[model samples]
Target: MLRVAVDRDGGVTLDDVADATREIDRVLEESDVMGELPFTLEVTSRGVDRPLTLPRHWRRNEDRLVKITLVEGGEVTGRIVASTEESATLDVDGDTREVLYADVAKALVQIEFNRKKKQNDSEDA
Candidate 1:
């Protein structure tokens, strides 16, 4: 199976996915890269649970909660406040901490469900 991941700022649209699929199909058909190999081309969006690796990934995930595993073996949970090509600044309990991308071993977006609801309920009191 050949999986293709396409992304854009904000998000990608259906047209983008369709166009990518068509382009990929055309390339595969024209080229002998597959060498008559039977393959399934699957184009899909990047999953929220995907690990953050590139600077673009970090930038796209700004304002989202993420659990970062440091190369030194410690883990940190924070919201991505800002990101640059070399590093990202995370807001950990209102304190901003800068983490270099090279120091990050793994980073995954944390899914939040009721946190917003709880926060709003407290504000209404």
Candidate 2:
């Protein structure tokens, strides 16, 4: 089975992953020469460590922390301030803002507070 992920209405919600995975499974079963059979499948949202390169990925992570590298060689690490079809606005410092897009050499979701807390708990335990 092929993996799939889709974010309808601009949100990478769990339902989005589920729907895409289901549809992909259906198509594969109907189209593939092999008859339908159980196969390993994994469908989930972008992880806390996932990179946000495409516009759809950015849309899914509208208000999360991210590190962005512009094609011009500038680097930005901050919260995702806003997003559009062409670019993403980031709140770098308290007042600074940078708009970047596919020209980005790299972009990744920054680890969040909750995730960090969980890590700490696991370590302590």
lDDT of each: 0.88, 0.70
Give the alpha carbon lDDT tens digit for every residue of 31-96 in model 2.
865455667766765565767767778777866778877788977888776778888877776765
Model 2 clash pairs are none
- List the RMSD of every prediction in angstroms: 5.6, 6.2
Compare the candidates by lDDT and give the number of the best one: 1
Clash counts for the predictions, in order: 0, 0
Q: Which 10-residue window in model 1 sums to the lowest lDDT?
A: 116-125
